[model samples]
Target: MSVAVASASAPARKALWKNLGVQVVIAMILGTLVGLLFPSFAAQLKILGDIFLRLIKTAVAPLVFLCVVVGVVSAGDFKRIGKVGLVAMLYFEIVSSIALGFGLVAGNLLGIGQGMSATTAASGVKPPSAAGAPHSTLEFILNIFPDNFIGAFARGELLQVLVIALIFGAALLHLKESKRLPIERGLNAISDAFFEFIHLIMWVAPIGTFGAVAFAVGSSGTAVLLSLIYLVLSFYAVVIAFIVVVLGGICAMFRINLFSFLAFIKDEIFIVLGTASSESVLPRLLEKLPTYGCSKQSVGLVLPTGYAFNLDGTSIYMSMGILFLAHAYNVPLDFSQQLGILAIMLLTSKGAATVSGGSFVVFAATVAATGVLPLEGLAVLFGVYRFMSIAIATTNVIGNSIATIVTAKICGEFDESVLARTVREEMA
Candidate 1:
């Protein structure tokens, strides 16, 4: 860990608002104020953020495709690429399980949902439609494989797109070096173009942040938030504990200072918070993690894959939300029942990102599948989803960033000096 002192020779800092993080933070503050004082006006501002999300959604599938494909061919080793992917998936499963079980344990121990039937009399938000909820494990597995290759991209199905990238990478891996280089170069160029596209889109991020936060607060209002303050605070408490205890321990094992690591990615983390969607920062993370000394291959494979497979925060929220419903509605879930829910969540949570409406949609699906938790109970949460998302999305981004670096280290693709350089900036 490098601890460089602040130096007089450092360049003058730009205007604070000119910085992306500053602009986003300012937008959030303005958004909250508007939500509190002028909700109707804030409601109208939601389209601004919707437009930004649409732009990000459109760009991500292709970008993931290109990143994995490019990462695969560029490394020039099929064995190494396969190893990294395998390791990342394993890490994702282990850590996500921990997150799942931890949430249940915490929620149960804290009785996080003990009295919700009386405190918040009416759920402010209407329940979301559960039309896409899968009925069985087999149905969920089949949903992952795309029927049409081009259609997958057209539909912006990330898991399908990921499948295509892996197959494409495998095909390229088998090609003669003479033939592969040209293809790799072409793909690399396209990937660079997409990165530039993300940069262009990012300029409008503050506008989007302002709109998203405004709409969330405007819709829910402080009244709704206060009613369920315990649930909100409890969930936040769990997320913070997970970060400090779980993620912090992982970083410690690698000798990486978690605080410095978080500081290095502060800008992207803020972007996630403002947008309340982890997908918004996908393009930026793809470009940034490599600078942390993680090999491009490891980053390209692990990070994009982590978005769906390794959402520690989402798992915790889903598990806790279910327990909250069960408790609030006076439903008792036995050990076997809770385990069944956990198993369902492990599958549904991975598909949440690929599905429209993200995790909440999937959360609804998981609830419906349980055949016990009152699906109606989900309305109790809908109003506060956006607020919870601010922290949830931040946690997901932080978790994935750490997962990528750890995967890189495991695969012998890390450079200590690069991380040292990154930490120096945080220290300074």
Candidate 2:
């Protein structure tokens, strides 16, 4: 009987090891090792990595659209949804500013870009102003209204889609019940279809993870790793502090246990770290939030919406990195100039997602907007940027997770009793 029980447990253990995320991490490590040892072989495998990233990008827009619509429409109260959104937006802004401030503080103290000779390596990339860039604020606002909805979606413009969805969802909520029910059902069905699509795409997650990690490790290697130890350590330390200080403060303010909240979402953190894209963990985070006292509608809405508005980690990195570069070049800016950066960064961070290299784009835009340093200063940080990307993306994941739960709890959508009971019982 004991042998039979052991045998049954063995298969389950094996199944656990085969979890998609676990498999992805293992694949990433193996791919990295391969790339480091055999660069030629790893180069051949580059297509595999590229395909995986493209796959994630492809799924992102539709998934976000469906989830956001469903989340908004399913809510029992429009006023309450608005309240939750207001709190979330306020939380995002305050925390993001704090993150930006911390980044500035850490970057100045550490001087990651110090002693680096400026280069024209990024010359051909087209500086925002020189490239005849439109006024960003006006452009950003204008782009929110899609001239072609299908075109916007095809181009994978998340901000535009989010704007459109929010407006449409609000309209749906204001409709008379008899008229609204069919539309709600249709939206729900579309959301279900998207979830099914998510499951289908998830099969490739392990492959993609391996590809991303391999590409990063192979392209960068341990030599770069060894050289940037101080900078890496500095960035990570700030990130950790942000999680503990900022998020923890909020959690405590709400009487939520920080440890319990983090413990419940440990797996989600690992996913974001390994993949370096918080969007990759959206479905899983949504699934897990209900278990953490968030209602299904709250989880569904907040998680997707937060991707655009509540990128706390990205905010921190952008703020810190820009200051680090400025300090490195010995560029002296007056208080007014610094204030200009602070103000522009607030808007640039919102447009951060629209750019190709995440924070790098925002960093570039910041340089342009600030007019404080040579634009090429952006590329000077490229080598270390990859290292910083991981830290930034990880923080974004944790911040959003905490934000979702706290917002849900505040709006009376989440169960305090469940949160308290679970923290005492199942949560570590």
Candidate 3:
């Protein structure tokens, strides 16, 4: 009996080792050890991460375009699309504002940077210039309308692609079924191909995860974390609170189980943790959210738009980060000033999803716009930024997932029974 049990268990153990999540966890551990042992060699492995990100990015533009177009066309009602967009934007604004306020309140209460000396701010890395500052509100609005249509996809500009897809999809809505069906079929075919490509790219995820984690640890070393550990811990705590109290409440209102929801997407969550890029899992969420009972139309529209406009996690980081800089620099900011920062963040955060290094760029731009916090203070965060980014990316993915489901419920497009059954099967 003992021998037979051992024989049966061997294959189960082998299967567990073959699981992607297990592989990623092992890679992260190995990467961390290698980074600690041989910093220089680990840093050289950064190319592996860069390659993985590049491949993921290659799929982003086409996948987004295809999804948005398909979603809009399938909905078959421009009025409904308009309604979904309005509700989504309104929800994003309210939640994000709450997030910003929560972060500020937490920062004030915790006093995270109170004892930190600004002398260490001189990290020799120059602060980003105001010249390359994020777009002003007017410029951002104008920039959404691409001057050249194809140029948008060629450049992989998300906002631009969104605009084009909206217009193209709406135009298709005006066409007769006979005329539009062929185009829809073609787009669906292309979308499938892109997803397949994503599957192939994902096989390299563990390798990429290893390289990325190793490089981050090797390049920065654990010493950086020790110095800013308080700020890091505080930020993480705020994020957790937001996820539980705020997002959890939202889930409760919709009759969804937050823990079950997390379990349903555990694979994607782990991927985001390893890659530290939310866009890395965008396609997967688009494919899976519908299976969780959100209408495909809602998943397609809300998820992508939420990426751009509904960054609850980023809002928390920006508000808290600004306050931390102010405290470290001994700069006095009254209630009105903090309110001003929140207002600016409302605009700047919208662009966070579309740009590279967006959070930092937006941070710099906000600081410059306010002209209160010292630009040098930005350098103080350099060492711990990568670590913070992992949390930010993970939270962003979770937040967007919830936003899609919530929007679906509000729009009367969700089936709770479908969600319950799907969650049970996935969890089982």
Cα-based lDDT for every prediction:
0.88, 0.72, 0.85
Q: For candidate 2, what is the TM-score? A: 0.86
Model 3 collision count: 0
TM-score of each: 0.94, 0.86, 0.94
lDDT score, candidate 1, position 158: 82
Runs in model 3 deviating more than 4 A are 1-14, 127-135
RMSD of each: 3.3, 3.7, 3.1
Task: Write the candidate numbers in order of decreasing lDDT.
Answer: 1, 3, 2
Q: Which candidate model has the greater lDDT, 2 or 3?
A: 3
Q: lDDT tens digits, residues 350-380, model 2? A: 7666555566666776777776676666554
Report the number of the highest-lDDT candidate: 1
lDDT of 1 by residue, 260-366 (tens): 78888889988998999899999999999888889888888888889879999899999899999999899999999999899989888888777777778889988
| Predicted candidate 3 versus true structure: per-residue lDDT over 1-428, tens digit per residue | 99998887754334777777778888888888988999999999899888988899899888888999999999888888888888988999999899889999999999978878744553555644445445688877886788998888777778888888899999998999999999999999999999899989989989999999899889877667777889999999989999999999999998889998898888888787877888889988888898899998888888988888888888888888898888888999999999998999888888776555767777777777887788777887766777788888888899999988888888888987887788676544
lDDT of 1 at 186: 89
Tell me the TM-score of model 3. Answer: 0.94
Clashing pairs for predicted structure model 1, backbone only: none
Clashing pairs in 3: none
